[model samples]
Target: MFAPTINSLVRYYHTFKFSHLDAAIVFFSFFQNMNF
Candidate 1:
């Protein structure tokens, strides 16, 4: 059940063509902003 959720997220990300680096940058910035 949990695995399918993760797989769907991965597929969605690929559908949008986000590179690993791009995703990392976005995640990092999101966390940084949330800390404020």
Candidate 2:
């Protein structure tokens, strides 16, 4: 039980981080496109 909870927390954290990174990448791409 303890191990499963820990794994879930780690998965949640990783997904959250990935989403933020993805958003930043999208925003950066938009700015670059606008400048061009």
Candidate 3:
């Protein structure tokens, strides 16, 4: 169940044409702005 959820997210990301680096950058920026 958890694996499927992760796979679906990965598929959706690819379908939207986000590169691995793009995703990583967005993720890093998001966390960088977090207070905790």
Candidate 4:
């Protein structure tokens, strides 16, 4: 019952973490481009 919800939440957390890292990398590259 509750197990499915917990599993989904855990998966979502991992996805969010990866997305956050991706955003950071993109932002860093954009900043470098602006500086150049």
All models: lDDT? Answer: 0.72, 0.64, 0.69, 0.63
- Estimate the TM-score of every prediction: 0.55, 0.49, 0.50, 0.48
lDDT of 1: 0.72
Deviation from native of the Cα of residue 24 in model 2, angstroms: 0.2
* Cα RMSD (angstroms) for every candidate in the order listed: 4.8, 13.1, 4.5, 12.6
On residues 3-30, what C-alpha lDDT tens digit does candidate 4 reach at each position?
7755764576577764777666755765
Give the clashing pairs for model 3.
none
**Which residue ranges in model 2 land beyond 4 Å of their true spot?**
1-18
In angstroms, give how far residue 18 of model 1 lies from its true place: 0.6
**Order by TM-score, highest first:** 1, 3, 2, 4
Segments in model 3 whose C-alpha atoms lie over 4 Å from true places: 1-15
lDDT of 1 by residue, 1-36 (tens): 657755765676789888888878766765577689
Question: Relative to the unseen true structure, what is the Cα RMSD of model 4?
Answer: 12.6
* Highest-lDDT candidate: 1
lDDT of 2 by residue, 1-36 (tens): 657755764576577765777766755765577689
- Candidate 4 displacement at residue 2 in angstroms: 46
Candidate 2 least-lDDT 10 residues: 1-10
